[model samples]
Target: MSQHPLARLKRYDIESITRYYRFRPWLVFARAVLIVWKFAGFLLGLRADRGHTNPIRRRQRAVQLRHILTDLGPTYIKVGQALSTRPDLVHKDFLEELTRLQDQLPPFPNDIAFAIIEQELERSVSEVYQTISADPVAAASLGQVYKATLHTGEEVAVKVQRPNLLPTLTLDLHLMRWAASWLGPHLPLNLGHDLLLIVDEFGTKLFEEIDYLNEGRNAERFAAYFKGDVSVKVPSIYWRHSSRHVLTLEWINGIKLTDVERVQAAGLDISELVRIGVSSGLRQLLEFGFFHADPHPGNLFATLDGKMAYIDFGMMDQLEQHDKEILIDAVVYAVNKDYDHLTQAFVELGFLAAGTDIQPIVPAIESVLGNVMGESVADFNIKTVTDKFSELMFEYPFRVPGRFALIIRSVVTQEGVALSLDPNFRILEVAYPYVARRLLSDESPELRRRLLEVLFKDGRFQWQRLENLIQIAQIDAGFDLMPTAQLGLQYLLSEEGQFLRRKLLLALTEDDRLHTDEVRRIWNLVKGEIKPDRLWGAALGALATVWPSATALVTAFTPSEQL
Candidate 1:
C-alpha cells in the first residue's frame, strides 16, 4: 500500500486538499493551475524589482494579469475580482493588478442583444423603442447594457446576457469540480474541502448573476431597504421587458464616482459624496445585514441632483442573525481591547475550535491593537491595520469565516476610497458612532422587556439548582451513597442509549432508502442481538421498556385547543 502525499501533511492540510479532490478531478487541476499562476506572478513581481529602471513594469504586470483574467472569460474575471479583496492572500502589487480586472468586457453582437430583448419582451425593437443605441453604454463580464427608449418616450437601460454564457459557465464549473476532486489527496495545502466550498459558492453566484430576474428582485429589495433615504438611489426594475436573461431598468444619468473632474463639473461635493457612500455602506452591513459586495467606483455613480446610485446588485452577501451579533461584538471588543471576550466570542462563533489554547492568540491580538489603538481613532491608518491583521492571521492560522473575510475587504476598500477623496475623513469616527447608537437601542423598552423575561427564567433556574444542591447534600449526609451513585450512573447510561436509538430511528425513517448493511447495523445496535454488554445492552433493554411511556407522555402534552 502506498502512502498518499496528503497523508504526509498535517491534519488541516490533509483536510483541505482532500475536500476539494473529492468533488471532481478537473477542479483539482484548476486549483493547481491557479496556485502555480500565483507563484509565477510573485516571482515576476520580484524580477520587476531587480534593476528595472522603469517603475511602470510593475503596473504593466498587474495590467497583464487583469487582461489574462478578462481573456479567460466571466468566471475567471469574477475569480480575479474576488482575489482583489483578499489582501491577506495576494501581495500589494498583485492586489492592484487583480483590482484592475475590470468588470467591463466588450459587448456581444448587437444583433444577439436585440434578439434577446425581442424574445424576452415578445415585441419587435421598433414597437418597444422610439430609439435604440447600436452601441452598448456599458459592458460587463456576464452581460452588456444598452441605452434605449420605450414607445411612450421613456428612456431606459437594457441589460442583455452575453450569448451562450450559461453553457460556458457550466463547462468551466464542471472542469473546476473535476480538478478539485483529482487533486484532493496530493496537495500539501488545506485546499481540499475549502476549495470545493468556494467552487460551489462561486457556481451558485455565477448562476444568479446570469439570472436577470434575480437581479431585478435584488434591485427591488435594495430599493425597499433604502426607501426613505433621500441620499441613496436604487434603480427601478422595468418588469415589462425583464426576463431571466434580459433586464430593463430606469435610466440613471450620473458621473462615475472615480471621474473626479466629471463629478466636479457636475457641481457635486466630493467630500459629502464620499461621506454618504461610507455611511450608506455601514448602514447596509450593520443595519440591514444584506449588502452590495461590489462597491467599486464603476458600480457607483453620483447624480447631478446630489443623489448616489448603486447600480449592480448581482453580487451580494448576507449575514445570519447570530453572525451579525458576533460581528458587532467583535468590533466592540476590538475597539476596547478586550482580548478574553474576543477569544471567547471567536470560539462561540466556531472561528476557533473547541479546547484550542487561547494564550497564543492574546499576544498577537494585543500587538495588532497596540500599534493602532495608540493613534486617534479618527486618524488610524486602515492599510497599516489591515496589513498587521493579515500577518497575524497567517502566523496564527486561525480559520476566518468566509463572510467575515468578505466584510473586512468591503470595509477596507470603502475606507481606502473614502480616504482617497478626503485624507482627513475618519471612517471609524463616522461608523463607530452609528454602531454605538444601535448598541444603545438594544437596551430600549422593548428589548428590556425581553431581557426581563430571560432573567426571570434564569432566576427560576437558579432556585431549582439551589433546591437540587440542598437535596444532594442531605442525601450525602443521610446515606453511604455508594449504591445510589452506581444506580444513577446506570440510569444515565440507559438514557443515553435510548436517546441514540431514537435518533437512529428518526434518521432511518427520514431516509427510506437505507442500505441492507445499515439496517442490519441499526437493528444490531438497538436490539442487543450482537456483543451485548451490561453497560450498553442493559441500557438498551431499559430504554425499550420506557420508550412507550415517553411517547405517551409527549402525546398527552399536545394541545387540543385551536386558535
Candidate 2:
C-alpha cells in the first residue's frame, strides 16, 4: 500500500522531526498549569467552597471563579468555557462564570502584527490601505481587529490572526488531550471521548478562524443567503487584498445588540430588532440550511437605519437536506404536540439510529416536550425549552451532531442577545407562524401524507386546522389550509386505498372466499385508528358488510373445529 501524504513526505526527510519535538517542553509546562487549575477546581467543588449550610460562601465562590478564569488567559478560557457547557462535567454556577471570558487581553506589538499582515496578503501596507489604525480596535483569543480604510476609500475592518498562534494552539491541544487521556479512566463519565470531541471541535474552529480567506468566503456565502433582504447586511469582502492570515471587509457601524440602554437612547425599536434576529435565525435553520453559526451580541449589530447586520462568519455551519427535513417535521410535531411522530422524527434524524424502536423513548420525549410546549404560545420560552431537555439528555443514547451543536449554540446566543434588547421577546412566539407556514407549504408526498394525519382523526375531519389557521394568521400571505385538506382527500382517493376496497369486494362476491386472516388484519387497524364514517373508515365498512356471508362460506369449505 502507498504511504499517506504526511508519511510519504517524511520518508524523504521533507519534514523535520525537530519541530515536532518542540511539543515536549510546552506539553510539560501546560500539564503543570493544568494540574494547578484542576487542584483549584477540586477545592472549589468541596463543601467548604459551597459553604455547607452557608449561603454567603456559596455566593462568594462564584465571584472567586470569575476572577480565576479572567486570570487564566486564552487556553483556559476556551477549554474551560467549552467544558462548562457539559452538564455532565461542570457545575451550573461554574459554567456561568467560565462563559464570561469574552473580552480579550492587550494587543501584541504593532510591528509584528503589521509584518504578519504583509506576509499573508503579499503586499506593502501602502498598496492596500489608504490608512490603517495604529492600534487594534478589538482583540480576541484567536485574532484581533483593526479599523482601516481600503485604497478605494471604502472603510473596512482588518482582522489579523495572532502571531505564532497555530503552533501554540497545537501545543496547547496536545497537552489538553494528553491530560484527558490520563484522566479519562478515573472519571465516571466518558471523559476521553467527550473531551477529545470538544477539543477537536475547538481546534477546527480555531483553524477556520485563522484562515482569513475561508472567513472571506463565508462572508460571501452569508451575503448570498440574505442578499435580497434590505434589513440583512453582510460586510463585503475585498478578495484582491485578503488572505489566510489577514481578512479585509466593509465595516459596520451600529449599536451592539447587548447595549440596551444605548439602543433605547438611539430610539430604535428593540422589539422589532428581536423579530428580525429571530426571523433571520429561522431562515438559516429551516430554509437555507447553511447558517452563520455564531450570532453572539458582539457579532450582531443593529444599524442606525434598523438593518440587522451579521459579522464574524468564520464560524459557520451547513445542515444537510435530510437533517433539515427531519428537523422541520420535528418542529411540526412539537407544534401539534404529537410526541409519537416527534419521537419518530427524533429517531430518523440521527438522534437515534435508523429503525431504532421509539416505544421506549416516546413517554420520556413527551415529558420533555410537555414542559416546553405546555405553556401557551405567547408565553413560550425557547431557552427554557432547551434547558428542560438538557436535564433529560443524559438518559438517552444521544450523540450531538456537530451541526446541531452549532445550531443550538447560535440559537441560544442570538436569543440571549435578543432578550438583552427586549425583556418581553420570545423567539418561539415569533418563530411559530414562520415555521407553521413552511410546514403547511411543504409539497413533499411524505410530508403531505403526514399532514393528512395532522388534519384528521381516524376517519373524521379535525377542524383544529382552523387553530393552525389562527397560529399562521400572522405569516405574510397566510397559508392555504385548504391544500392540507385537499391532500388528506387525495390520500383516501389514491389508487392504494381504492385497490384495498376493490380487492376485498372481489374476494368476497366473486369467489365466495375471503382471506379470513387478511380481513381481520385490515379491520383491526380500521377499528383502532380509522374513524368508521370517515373516508377510509366508510370504505372499510363496505368491505366488512360482506364478511358474514364470506365467513360462512369459508367455514363451509373447511372442516370440524374451523366451523
Candidate 3:
C-alpha cells in the first residue's frame, strides 16, 4: 500500500500513537518506533515529569492542539467544530479542547493577496479601488478582509483568498476520507459515513465560500428578502469588481454586535437589538429557508443608525421547502410534547431510522427540556438546551443530516449571542411568535388548488382502471378452458399494468423534469413489464419506452444550437 501523504505531514507523537493503537490495533508493532524516543526523553528528564502535569500545562496543551488544528488547515478547523458537537464521538476533554480551535489564521503576504485580487478581477488594484490598504483588517481560515475604497469613492471591504488554500484543503479532505475508510469497519461508530459526509459538506461549503460570485448573490438575496425592513442591513455587492475569489462590498463603520456597552453608548437599545437579532435569524432559517450559517458576533455589527449589518456571506446554508416544513413540524411537536409525532417527523426527515424505538427516547428528551420550556424566555439557558441535545444525540446515536446539524448549531449560537447581550433574552419567546405568525399566515392558495387537481386526476385514472378490469373479466368469462383462463388473467394483469403506466406517465409528464432519477426509474419499470401483444398495454408501454430516451436526448442537446 502506498503510504498516506498526510502521514508524512503529521507529527508522530504519544497521542498519535495512542490514537493509532485504539483505531488500528494492527499498528501495535509500530509502537516500538514511537516508544524509543519517549523513553530516551523520559530518561533525560526532558519530557513532562509528574509535577509538570498541572492544570496550567493542560491549558497549554489545549492551546497547542488549537494551534495545531488551525495550522493543519481550514478543513481541520471545520472538523474541530464538528467533533465538538458530538461528545459521544470524541472524548470530553478533547471536545472541550477542540472547541477553542479558532479561525484566527495569520494573513498571507500582502503581495500574494494583491496578486489574487488582480487575477480574480482581471485588473490592477488602482483601477477598481481608489485606495487599497496593504494590511488586512481581519484574517480567518479561508480568507482575510482588507478595508479599501472604490474608484467611485465608496468605502468597501475587499475579501481576498489566502494563497494556495484550496490545494491544502483538498489534500486534508482526501486524507480525512482515506483515514475514515481505513478505520470505519473496526470502529464502534459509523465513522466512515459520518466522516465522508462531513468532509463532503465541508468541501461544498468551502468551495461556495471561495466562489465570491455565489457570496455576492447570497448577500443580494438577503438584502432583497429584507428590503422593506429598516432595522436590518446586508452589504451591497459590487458586481463589477467581484469574481469567484474576490468580493467587494459596502463596508459599514459600526461596532460589533457583541459590544453591548459600545452599542448602548451609540444610542441603540441592546434589548431591542437582541430581539431583532434573534427574530432575524429565525426568519432566515424558517421563512426564507436561506441563512447565514456562521452568525458569530464578529460577523454582525451595530451601525450608528441602529441598523443590524450582517457581514461575511462566505458560509450560507439553504433549506429545501420540504426540510423547512419538517423542521417546523418537529419544533411544534417538541413544544407540544408530542413524542410520537416528533419521532415520526424525525423518521420522515431522515434524522432517525424507521425501526428505531421511540419509547426510550421520550423520557430522555422530556427530562432534558425540563423547566427550561416553562421558564420565561429571558430565563431560559440556550447553552443548557444545546448541551442537552448534543448529549442526547450522543447517547442515542441518531444520524442527523449535516445541513440540519449546521442549522441547529447556528440557531443555538445566535441564541447564545443574544442571551449574552441580555440575560433576560428568551429565544423561544421571540421564536414562538414568529413561528405562530408563519403557521397562521401561510395560506398557500395555489398549492391547495394544485393538490386538488392532482386528487381529481388520480380519481379519474382509478375509475378508468376499474372499467378496464370489468371489461377483462367479461373476456375471461368467454374463455372457459384453463390455458385460455390463465392467458385471460395475464391479459387483465397487463391491462391493469397499462393503466398504472399511463397514470405514472401522465404524472411524470406534468411534473417538472428536475426529478430525472425518479422519472427514469418509473419509466424503466413500465417499459420492462408491459408487452405489445396486450392492446391496452402496448400504447402505454410504447410511450414509456420512448419517453426516457427522448428526455435524455433533449436534456443532452438542448444546450447546443444544432441543425
Candidate 4:
C-alpha cells in the first residue's frame, strides 16, 4: 500500500501545515473570487434576458457551481451537501447538481489513508488487523472506509479521516463566517435568519462530522434508540480500534436501498423497507428526538431479512421535547387543514419570527398546504410540498430554522430513497398512520391535549375526524386497537376528561335536540371496528361506572335517533 503511485504527496498534519496556512488563505480567497465571478456572470446573463431565466442556462450555471464547490474541496463540498437539502435556499436546478456532493468525491490514496489509520490507532495496520482491503470500499467528503478483519477474527469496516483537516476546517470556517457577515445583507436571498447564523450552523455540524469519536458515540446512541427492534439495524462500534480520526464498526452486509434491482433480487420487500424507514424516522424525531440527519442512499441499506440498516452517524441532530410536541401539533393542524393553528405552529417553530404579523401568512399557508391532505396517497409526497413551500418561503417571511435543516434533509432523502424503490410510495401513507397511532395510543399529557384538539373543535365532537383517524391508524401494523381503546377509556375516566365530558354532554343537547343519532353512529363505528367480545364487555363495564343506566344507554338509540 505504501508503494502505491498515488501516495506521492508528503504526509500532512496540523504542525506540518503551518507554512501552508499562510498562503492557504490567499488560495482560498482566489478560488472564492472565481466562484463569485462565475455566479455574477450567470446573474448578468439572466438580467440580460430580462429575468426570464432559461432552463438550459440555469442548468449550465448549476453545473459550473457544483464543479467550483468540488474544486474548492471538503469544506465547500460539505457546504454544497447542506445546500442540496435546502430547497428554500437553492434553486432546484442548483440543488440537483449539488446533490452529487453527498458522495462521488475522488478518493485519497490508500497508502496515505492507511498511514492515517496507523497513526490514529497507534499501531501498524498489520498488528491490529488480520487482513485489510488494499483500497477503500467507500470514500466520503471527510473520510474513506476500508474493509478489514481483526486478529480476533471479527470483520469490521475501518473509517479513516483525511489528514490535516483541523487547520483547514478551522481556517475555512472562520473565512466563511467572515464572508457571510460581510456579504449577507447585499445578497438577494430570502432568509428568515441572518446568513451568518446559517454559516455557523453548517460549520458546527461539519466540525462534528469530522470527529470520528463523536460519530461512533452517535452510532451507539442511535442503536440504543432502536435496541431490540428487529426491523432496523445499526452497526456496532469497535471501540477498541476506534479513535477521533478512525472508526471500526461491525461490517454490515446489506443491499443498498437505492439498488432497486439488487434489493428486489434479494427477495426483500422494498415497500416494507420503506415503511420501516419512515416509521423508524418518525420515532427518532417525535419520540426519541435524536435522528440520523444524513439519510442519503449511501447511508441506508436493506438487509436480506428486510431490515433497514442505517450507517454513517457522522451527521445527526436532536429536537427538544417542546419542539417535538410542536411538530406533532403542526402535523395535526395541517391534517385538519386548520391553517390558523398551523401558522402559529410555524411561529412557534421559528419559521416565522415573533410579531411577524401571521394574519396574512395564514391564508398564504392555507393556499399552499390546504390541498396536501386531500391528495391521494399515491400523489402526496414531501417533494411536492417542499417545492411549493420553497415558493411560499420566497413570497412570505418564512425562514428555515437552522435546526430543521437536517430534519428536512433526513425526511426528503428518505422519501427520495423510497421513491427510487417504488414510484408510488408516499411518505404520508406511512407517516400519517404512525402519527395517528401515536395520537390514539400515546398517554403523554402533551399528545393527549393534541388528540383532544384534533377530536374536538367549536365545542363539538368531530365524529368524522375521529373515524378518519381510526381508519388511518388501522393502517399501521404496530397500531393495536386494544391499547388505543384502553387509552381513550383511561383519559375519559381521568380528571383531565372533565373538559371532554362537559363538551360531550353539551354536544348531546346543544340545540335543545337529542344528538343520539351521532352518539349511535360512534357506538356503531366502535362495534363494527372492534369485534372482540372481551373488548365490548370491558368497554361496557367501564362505561357502566360513569353511566349507571345501561337500559337508557341502549334506549338512547331508538329508530328515530339511531345511526
Best by TM-score: 4
Residue-wise C-alpha lDDT for candidate 2, range 326-417, written one tens digit per residue: 77667667877788988888667655667777788888878876876666666667677666655555666544544476677777788888
Lowest summed-lDDT stretch of 10 residues in model 3?
476-485
Candidate of highest lDDT: 4
TM-score per prediction, in order, is 0.68, 0.75, 0.67, 0.87
State each model's CA lDDT, in order: 0.66, 0.67, 0.64, 0.80
Q: Is candidate 1 or candidate 2 better by lDDT?
A: 2
lDDT tens per residue, model 4, 487-547: 6775687676888878878877878998788777767656655756657555655565556
| Least accurate 10 contiguous residues by lDDT in model 4 | 4-13
Ranking by TM-score: 4, 2, 1, 3
Candidate 1's residue-wise lDDT over 350-436, tens digit each?
656678788888887778777786754565666677777656655665555566656766777777777766777767666555544
Residue 285 local lDDT, model 2: 85
Cα-based lDDT at residue 489, candidate 3: 35
- Over 4 Å off, model 1: 1-64, 87-93, 190-193, 348-351, 442-563
User: What value does the lDDT take at residue 89 in candidate 4?
Assistant: 78
Query: How much does each candidate deviate from the true structure in C-alpha RMSD?
Result: 19.6, 12.6, 17.9, 6.5
